[model samples]
Target: MAEPEDKTRRAPLDAVGRFTATEAVAAALSLIWLVAVAAYSFTAPDGTGPLGIVMTLMMVFLPIALIWVTVTTLRSVQELRAEATRLQSAVESMRNAYVTTQVQPSVQRKLEEIERTAKQAETALATFTSRRDASLVVASADRKAAMAAPARAAPAEDQPALALGTPAEDLRAPLSVGDFIRALQFPESPEDKDGFRALRLALEDRAVAKLIRAAQDVLTLLSQEGIFMDDLKPERARPELWRSFAQGERGRGISGLGGIRDRSSLALTAGRMREDPIFRDAAHHFLRTFDRTFAEFEKTATDAELVDLADTRTARAFMLFGRVAGVFD
Candidate 1:
């Protein structure tokens, strides 16, 4: 059955509208002319010849035919316009149906997850910048000196121990793997005293500090390309895989460790590696430092600690650069 009429449809006299005033006038005038000519032809003038009769017939049919052609053209145009409207409606319906069927929860979840990560990174950056010149900086310097002093120490006989049996260096216990991992992540906020404390301890370990500084350099370079270590989401490889890479395995043997698969990031990094010699050198140095540090870290670090360390921003940066450099093939 035909659907109920659309009241708003003004389309081309398909259902509701009447013929226009001009069309109606033309049709009425043509019919009047035809009737008048027929009547005049019947009451022919006396002595009229065949020429006059032909002329009468010509006048009778010509105007009517022209008006019929005009009306037919208008109807064709109206039908064309109606067809166009139906085509547009069909397209709109198809688009809405496609959108309804194609959208999925996974894509929405991924976007939401990405947004949350970005917010967290922004918060961490703002917090770190505000506290950059506070007590943290001072403690950092003191820690560096304390760390270096141990290296430049005089003979054991020449230097005296602290009260009781504690050496000056022994006052603080060794930096634990947990603290090292925390330092790699850096302070999340000015109020996170534990984060700050772990960083300070990490700085006091000369080896770890050197690695930290190298990682910092690489991170700074990466930022110029709008890539952030915090934004990277590398696949978490097993601790055994990292240990395998640290033990001098290369190519596919440790390839799983390089989980940074973002094509744009890799392309930008690859371009920089080829064009900038200084950046290339620094990246290589950072990789070496990370490799060495992780080797030592894994020896005493539990599997969970190793995974946490791998997830840190510093380690993420390493994964990005390492993948680009083909360190893990």
Candidate 2:
């Protein structure tokens, strides 16, 4: 409604025949000059020849022609004014957009959240890097210590052998499937006392200890390539599918168990397998270890326990690395 009213409003130069104040004033002056010229042409003291008639006609219309030309120039000026108004409107809209962006609440919060997550990932990666090297050192040193142990403590030939002391692991309770899954996730942080406790208990089991060590090595190596189990979100397979895998099913029958579908992760793993010999070896070792250990555990694991195990970070890594290794194909 307001737009219609604005369109109807008067302008100096409109679509209809109209004149500006200056143009009207100029026309009035030109009319007066024509009247004076008519009076002189009729009442001239000199002879009224054809030359005098020609001069009078020129004087009559020249001022009106000049005024008409000036009005056309003023119409061009009016168009320029309209364009300047539109440009001013566009500038105002841009300023309003800038103000709106500044007031959005999530902008600042999202930035902070992203920064915090990146720092946490960096810390976890660094921790595992050290653990990977330490595990290698500890495994080699243990081999050396075990080989030297028999020579250091020789059995007596005649004297009665003293009763052998109980092994260190005999004092600790056996690791349960639940504890094994928790241990595979590893301690969330230094303050995660419960998580650490579960890991320590799981480590007491001879078979589980080997699987956990292999998992840690593969996890640490994958992190070096910027892939983390925490970042993967595998599509959860059915418990029956997991049971089939545990029961030695292979190929497409159990292919649904490979739930990791992130293309970028698969590409990275495939590339690493092709280019990095150490990473490829570690991946193969982890998968074989996981498959054998998990099959044994599945014999006793309830459907709920199986689901929980599948949800563990270690299981997720298996899905990702195994798919790239053609375990699901």
| Candidates in order: C-alpha RMSD to true structure | 11.7, 12.7
Lowest lDDT sum, 10 consecutive residues, model 2, at 141-150
TM-score of each: 0.58, 0.58
Provide the overall lDDT of each model, using Cα atoms, as 2-decimal numbers. 0.75, 0.74
lDDT of 2 by residue, 170-283 (tens): 565456555677888898889999789878876777778888899999999889889988888787676778888888888888889889988988898899999999999999
Residue-by-residue lDDT tens digits, candidate 1, 11-126: 64543256666578788989899789768766976437998768776788888888878877876777777778877877888999988777767788899999779655654553
Candidate 1 residue 182 Cα shift, in angstroms, is 2.3
Clashing residue pair totals per candidate (backbone < 3 A): 0, 0
Off by over 4 Å in 1: 1-167, 188-194
**Global Cα lDDT for candidate 1:** 0.75
